[model samples]
Target: MMYKAFFNALTGAALLALAGAAAADDLVLEDAWLRAVPPVSPTMAGYFTLRNDGDQAVELIGAKTDIAGMAMLHDTETTDDGQARMVHLSGITLEPGDEATFAPGGKHLMLMKVDTIPEAGESVEICLTFRDREDLCGDFPVRREAP
Candidate 1:
């Protein structure tokens, strides 16, 4: 009887520890996800709304995705010649209350030279390199929809 009680207590303690670990690593991602594209599409994009809840400023430098070998921060702009082009972003700085958005036809994750087109309900991982901090891996699932 004593051994049974000890095992029950041990299980409860383990469950509590696991819950705490998950809570500690949780990040608040608002409107976070990937953009879906048609099959045989060579390139795609991703959009999100990011809010920095941490104390310090964060720089969004670069990203990596498995759908494509490279996931880069890109911005679209119209040139003097009336042409649109994408430029690689060095980084985006966010103040404590500031927010950054990745939207279609604007600032977004450029999935150039895609290797495999993700299914409509699959998930992709992005590794974002931050300035003066460790890289963050954010998971975004795929969903097909029009802009």
Candidate 2:
């Protein structure tokens, strides 16, 4: 009886581990980093490329970080007058095998009212939430200069 219970528990654990692995394989985050801002600056920007490897589409709904009071998705657009303005986005969608890049002067994650200014070479934790996939949390490096 003891052997049977132990075997069942191990099997359950293995199944859960496999499920987690499969979930993680659905999405990939690459080259995540936070652009360094001045010590008294209230906002910073985070850039990354998110790739969806699954057969279905994924929607990046939002982002959050402990180091910021609020995080939001934004895009830079040119107006009729040729003035560049920042626009807020509700969410972004990615098709299968598609990669969405968040870069400076383009689409980016805006970190507002930062609690503390992160130093260069520091790693900050940011969580990206998707509509139908598991949240992706990564340690994004802080860079003093744009690459």
Candidate 3:
């Protein structure tokens, strides 16, 4: 009976360790926020950081938000003439243990045809669809200042 009890305890401990590891491998979203545009502006921007801790790489394929009629991924590229332009991106790949950041003057989400502009301190739900992983939905706060 003592031997059986020891085996059971060891099994339980192993299971707990596995669970902890899985939790650590989960993807994490940090500092999600949207830039507040003027009421007359037709477009706004969204930014965030996506961290992947899992063993496999993932691709961000698309994004959607109710606040805008259309949402798309974009990258800001500077030309030789010192002019910057927005380039649309179909998807962004992030390797395991890597992170992607969306910020002003860099990679960002273009929110076009905004139906309404949320006031500062309000939150907008943005759903990010992945290529092979489950989608992640985050509530991004509207802020005038940089994140």
Candidate 4:
């Protein structure tokens, strides 16, 4: 009888842990892709759609990738002269059901000091650091156009 009770408790605890883990991760990254740049290019741009599916708000602090010396968030802005320029973004916050789209002429991931630009038909992994949970990673396919 004691062994049976212990087994039940253990099973219950394991289930609870699994539920907690699922609840802890609330951010989903989709449509992740890297802009295919020239082989001699030292910088590249990565774009993706980030969605918050959980009830709570998620704050994205930064991004990192082994393929680049540094990865930073950026956005394109038009000046009074109608010229476009890239601005650095410190972070992004998304509420439940909110989706942030990183695309051309808009928010993007600027990967600088790349040792070797990944060719088209290849993929790279980029991890996003969040303030409320563990880092979330997604595979970004190298391409000339959005897919």
Candidate 5:
């Protein structure tokens, strides 16, 4: 009975480990970084390229970080008067093998009311939520330029 219980437990642990690895393989974030700003700045921008490697689609619903009061997806667009403005994005969908780029003057992550400011060489944890899967988190390096 003891051997049976030990084998069952070991098998369960192995299955869980495999599941985690599979989930992580479903999505990938590359070149993620947050823009460096002055200490007094209230907002910061983050950029990254997200690729969907899963067999199904994934919709990015939102983002969250402890360093900021609120984290959200945003996009820059030219208004009817040709004035540049920033707008909030509800969500973005990516099909299998699709990728999305978040860069300056385009779709990006807007961290508002930053409570904890990370130094230029530091990094912060940012988690992005999806409609079809669990939240994916990564460390975004703070930098003056793209990495």
Candidate 6:
């Protein structure tokens, strides 16, 4: 009986955590970092693991960042022509008690026009909006890219 009660309490805390920040809320970052690129690159992408922790569902709406001119949701899709292309996305849905990985060649955040190349060990702040737009607002911080 005591063990059961303890488990319940632990579950409740996890739920509350999901109720908080979006990025580290239900999801966790695994070796998360920004991509290093040339000054001429129009955009860069951040990669991380999005671990779902709730019992319902979640979606990624939009993103914001000061490190770049613009930050938005994006995906790498394979076209019928046998070519892979980068597509901007409005949002993403996640199953309750599950996780969705936001990484290269998958659902990810598109950061446009970086003014500076972020140094390693630095963290970039990003806010992820959710579909519900009510209980979902995640702030993502990733280590800067390495050489």
Per-prediction tally of clashes: 0, 0, 0, 0, 0, 3
lDDT of each: 0.76, 0.91, 0.88, 0.91, 0.92, 0.67
Where does model 1 exceed 4 Å of error? 1-27, 78-83
TM-score of each: 0.71, 0.88, 0.81, 0.88, 0.88, 0.66
lDDT of 2: 0.91
**What TM-score does candidate 1 reach?**
0.71
Query: Can you tell me which runs of candidate 6 are displaced by over 4 Å?
Result: 1-27, 79-81, 133-147
Candidate that would win on TM-score: 2
lDDT of 1: 0.76
Report the C-alpha lDDT of model 2 over 13-44, residue by residue, as the tens digit. 99999988977887899999999888899999
TM-score of 6: 0.66
Which ranges of candidate 4 are over 4 A from the true structure? 1-5
Query: Once superposed on the true structure, which residue ranges of model 3 sit more than 4 Å away at CA?
Result: 1-25
Which candidate tops lDDT?
5
Which scores higher on TM-score, 3 or 4?
4
Better of 2 and 6 by TM-score: 2
Worst 10 residues of 1 by lDDT: 20-29
Residue-wise C-alpha lDDT for candidate 5, range 1-147, written one tens digit per residue? 999999999999999999889889989998999999998899999999999998888999889999999999999997789888889999999999999999998899999999867889999999998986789999999998777
